[model samples]
Target chain A: MYQTNQLADATINKSESAVDVQPDLNQYLMAVASHQDKAAFAKLFAFFAPKIKAFGLKQFRQEALAMDLVQETMSLVWRKAQLYSPEKGKASTWVFTIMRNYSFDMLRKIQHNKEDNLSDDLWPLYEEAEPEPDYEDDHLMREQLIQGLEALPPKQKEVVEAIYLKEMTHQELAEHLGVPLGTIKSRLRLGLEKLKEKMELHND
Target chain B: MIKHHPESTMIHAFVAGELPASLSIAVSAHLELCPHCKAIADKATKAMADEFSGNEALVELAEPTPAQPVDEFATMLAAITEQPTDAPALKSAAVESSNQMALGEKTYTLPRALRQFSQTKWSGLGNIQRARLGLDEGDVHASLLQIDADSAIPHHTHKGYELTLLLDGCFEDESGRYEKGDFIILNGEHHHSPYTAEGCLCYTVSNAPLHFTSGVSKLLNPIGRFLY
Candidate 1:
């Protein structure tokens, strides 16, 4: 169960065509983590370029800002690849983190210019893992994670989905749910804590 | 351990990037060794990742579009290498404040730094040794009151108002348990038979000394007046 989810960090879309050129996801990550592997780099670029662009477009609300964020996020991946721990998170989450950080930078920039602090209420800043210069495994420990999430109660699932997927902070989720900030946090904590208990057994 | 506080909204500050860096790293190290925290983190992170992926459709259908690449961002990859590790910086001498060690709690700290007058002044009271810290602050007048955690201060109420933020362990009165980071607000209407559980340390700020409702203990009110 754990081995399967391990591959999650790779950009290999379970639905998309499998990336064939590499020995495995981990190996591929380590090999091209440095700027030297242009072939691997090109492959990665093809995978993330559009995702980054789309990611930025959502946040900046302008084509140019989105492109800049995309470019910056990818470039950051290029440098930090060595720091990416295959054990920490999936590839998509990592890249998402970079874009998220870029968004935060934009928020700070907005604040510096005396603009409204919209990001002020946003919590849960997810970070991207850098490209790993060394990944020894091809498998991922994700099945446990997936199964755990599937087991959550509907309301808990909804809360998790809204806050995490929608990028709404706890405060934002609270406003949307018409609940107290404490209630939102309690839901998040309780939901995740239950999932964690189930996952620990599966991972073990 | 299930911390059953009615208000124990313990979000992984680590996940939120809001925790101090060293603490976050410490938690990460623990995650690698203890599947407990890791699985917890994994569930949160994976759920979050899935949520974001699903939202891709909604975002694509909207908007005037984002800006193009800027020179600062273009150089981001290179910049990541030069940036320092996201580790929290721990100063050499972190515990210099007037926080005193309560006897029964085994150990308690004076807050780190800001107490520069050689040593704290410990005055003896019944069954407990009290310490006076001249460390003053805004609305809350700061002082270090160390009582044997096992011993209870005689019943007392405030003349003004008082605020206490717990720093070490739990302290319980008629109100409830106060763990670390617990900020307790008490006014003249409040009276507590406060005692530390297994002994604890509390950083207290009071605008005035406490006034006893009824007791020969009311005699302390005169001194509490000058102290407050």
Candidate 2:
């Protein structure tokens, strides 16, 4: 079971048809977001409610709780549709995140008898991941990093070298250099600022 | 270096939202500090989404009839559309506050998962201080544990499972040194005294209390519930 799940995780949905499905859903979601288009929302609800219910049933194993999960999650989708951005992820992923969160909170309520809604606190729906750069931008950044490394002062350069080049964690580097962790952090901060400046300067 | 991590199966379960909050928060805190684990979590989440997307055929089999009929869907949509969307309450990611804890003169930045219990007070004995998170996980307990510099925790083993994610500084046990972002899960078979040179803060969750193993520390076994 574990091996299958791990294998499934490794093989992401890369098919063209699978890729094609996301944009259409994104459009429907956008329609719902821009205008309170009930038709667009209805489409989403029709598509997602069963899946959410299916997921909830697997997790909760009780019929009423599963139904409640569907209601709560769909209602949330209706309300929070505007927050969805294609840059963040596909529409299905967004809905899955919401469904799983509700499922988690419901379990907490039932098992622990804790009424506090801690799901959002643990996994903030609005929080976005750091924007990923495409391959070209990555190459450009590497070039800038080399130039940036050259421009750094000896002390700051060593910290950046150890961190980015050698992939040494701040704690490890501190221990390696026999310096306080605070000293390593300060050097890293300064070094990072210089690197960012170099990148921005190259861009300009 | 982060030598220890939660198992891959654990990460999958975490992404699937199968773990209890007590255990989930420990993973969340570790993910905040470990980019490697974060990448794995992101992939798992994506795969979960794909699974849901692809399960339309299976969903039909599992769910023979629509739970909510087409007509009721319209009603729910109308009701939902009528409601005002809530603005996000906490901009936790961008708006940083003093979500930190002090162990003596030095303060360490608490992870986002722990920010909720930032105000909890600390109680201590000797070179150790602990703040319970008040998570209602039955037998399970979650806490922020602080070890003062040049101090050693009594040699002990877990009764069930103990998951400790180092939030700051470093500590070494008989097995190895654990630094920030290390996710170390110890079972009953493992027994060691953790000592730190610069002191450290950790988010620890355990299903059962510690069993002090040796000498004078064995006296602490009776009060282990309070200490763990």
Candidate 3:
């Protein structure tokens, strides 16, 4: 479970699909933005909608709400695609940010509709800044990062994924994993440091 | 220059949209003031996006739902493609108003992100003046605090965590001098009295009440409950 260098090599050698799809994803987003390309939109919808639905299900624990999140997120992506630029970030990053924002909005709306005493003025004030380009070709960087994650010690990987992907609080994650809170923090810190080092080394 | 900033972990949570709404707003305000943190946030966001898009297994698991009707897809496609109108003008108006927050004789130009919430009435608490921002519906409390020049807050420590964003003037505590746009976070381990030479205004959020730690101010611990 703790194998590091070997696992990194193995995962990188095996997972070629991860490296292949990102440029095409970027192109699809650009086509949708430049022209109202229905074919491009359909392709994006086919790829991202289900994954977004899975995300919503994990967060909300309700199938109907998850489906709604998928629809709302995809619709926003369509309307806002023109704002996307490869110079700023990858298409997936842009879409993921939109989905995350939409999820919060939907949650807030539900909470507001349920309680009369709560203030109705609950909208967040800040708009998301455009993503900064960290790598000239983000797809290659992503492939390396995925390989890095695969290389992490299992415990560290679990903690990193829970915090970054599942949105769990440190305390909650500790409880969920039945580990000491300090252990969770250390694991997360170490995992992130290693991942950052790997990405930086790859870029250099 | 900003002497303080939210930690990288906090910024990661903010970019991932994992923070609660009140904390998110406070971090957002800080982002507008601190370019250093904003650049870090952008990088974190890009990395998360790359990781998300690279997950071929997750994408593959989501086989196209056969149940989604063709007409529904068509309707959604049409809705998304509709041309937006006059949005830029409306956005500029909003941005223009957010720059000025009026209280008494002074008008503070706030960051654009904080301009949307309408201000509530400020209530005087000794030398400190405070107004609650009704921007979130939860247990986490957020407010604007104004301390008069040459005044000091009683020494205190937080029960959970307190995040304060300095919006105007400067204040000093045992930790260091905090100027406009400094983002400070204090936890249970910290105990300091904050003082200002020039009266300061700040946006603050706390998960729990602050516990007053010194002198006659201990009597006002109950009042500190309402202040946070």
Model 3 regions more than 4 Å off: A1-18, A111-204, B55-97, B135-138
Query: Candidate 2: where are CA atoms >4 Å away?
Result: A1-20, A128-204, B55-70, B87-98, B102-104
Candidate with better TM-score, 2 vs 3: 2
lDDT per residue as tens, model 1, B174-202: 87776654455678889876876455555
lDDT of 3 at A156: 91
Q: Which candidate, 1 or 3, would have the higher lDDT against the true structure?
A: 3
Candidate 2 per-residue C-alpha lDDT over B12-85 given as tens digits, one digit per residue, 9 for 90 to 100: 99888888888888887777676678778888998899888763311111222578455544555567768876
lDDT of 3 by residue, B1-228 (tens): 787989999899887777766777778778777667877887898788766666562122233356955554445555655645223233234224345778877898776556654366788978888888775656678888888889998899999888999989999999789988899988999999999999999989987888998889999898987778
**For candidate 1 chain A, which ten residues in a row score worst on lDDT?**
A117-126
Full-model lDDT for every candidate? 0.50, 0.76, 0.71
Tens-digit lDDT track for model 3 on A1-204?
Answer: 112334235335535644445545656676676665666676677678767878889888998899888887888677666666554455687788778877777776776442221111122222233323223243675668779999999989988877875455676566446689999999999999999998888888
Query: What's the candidate order when arranged by decreasing lDDT?
Result: 2, 3, 1
**Candidate that scores best on DockQ:** 2
DockQ numbers for every candidate? 0.07, 0.20, 0.12
- Provide TM-scores for the models: 0.38, 0.74, 0.68
* Interface Cα root-mean-square deviation for all models: 12.6, 6.6, 7.5
